[model samples]
Target: MKAKVLVTLKTGVLDPQGKAVQHALSSLGFAGVDDVRQGKLIELDLAETDPAKARDSVEAMCRALLANTVIENYSIDLVD
Candidate 1:
């Protein structure tokens, strides 16, 4: 099984890295680019076969290590 995790900062939190990227884009002649937010993608390979179980395990992974629940939110997807 394959699992994908997307980790992103909470909406109200300040994102300095994202702001830097936004500024760089505009400087490079990418006009009309209003907002930019940066996030992380993590892909995991698992031996578990059941989608339900795989999702549960990955969710646990996120809570334990993959994501910082205080300032970040995570979304998970499972694929065969």
Candidate 2:
């Protein structure tokens, strides 16, 4: 089984890195770049095949170490 985890900062959180990137893009002559936000994607290869079990484990992983729930939200997707 394969799992994809997308972790991103929640709305209303200040994203300095994103802001810096946006500024850099604009300075590079990239027009109309209104905003930029950065996030993390984690891909995991698992031995389990059951979707339900994989989801459970992935969620656990997110809560435990993959994501910082304080300022971030994460979604998990399971694939063959």
Candidate 3:
């Protein structure tokens, strides 16, 4: 099984890195972009065959280490 975890800052949280990227884009003449946010993509290859189990494991991973639950939100995508 394969799992993809997308971790992003929660809405309303200040994102300095995102702001920096936005500033850079505007400086580069990309004025159409009103905002920029950055996140991380984590791809995991798992030995578990059961979709349910794999999802459970990934969810645990997210809660334990993959994401900062207080300030970040995460979504999971599973593939065969």
Q: What lDDT tens digits, residue by residue, belong to model 3 across residues 1-80?
A: 99999999999999999999999999989879888889999999999999999999999999999999999999999988
**lDDT tens per residue, model 1, 1-80:** 99989999999999999999999999999999889999999999999999998999999999999999999999998877
User: Worst ten-residue run, lDDT, model 2?
Assistant: 71-80
* Model 1 clashing residue pairs (backbone): none
What's the lDDT of the predicted structure labeled candidate 1?
Answer: 0.95
The window of 10 residues in a row where model 1 has the poorest summed lDDT is 71-80
Q: Put down candidate 2 lDDT per residue, 1-80, tens digits, no spaces.
A: 99999999999999999999999999999999999999999999999999999999999999999999999999998888
Clashes of 2: 0
Q: How does each model score on lDDT?
A: 0.95, 0.96, 0.96
Candidate 3 lDDT (Cα, 0 to 1): 0.96
Model 3 ranges with Cα > 4 A deviation: none
- In TM-score terms, candidate 1 sits at 0.96
Candidate 2: residue 6 lDDT (0-100): 99
Candidate 2 deviation (Cα RMSD):
0.6
The TM-score of predicted model 3 comes to: 0.97
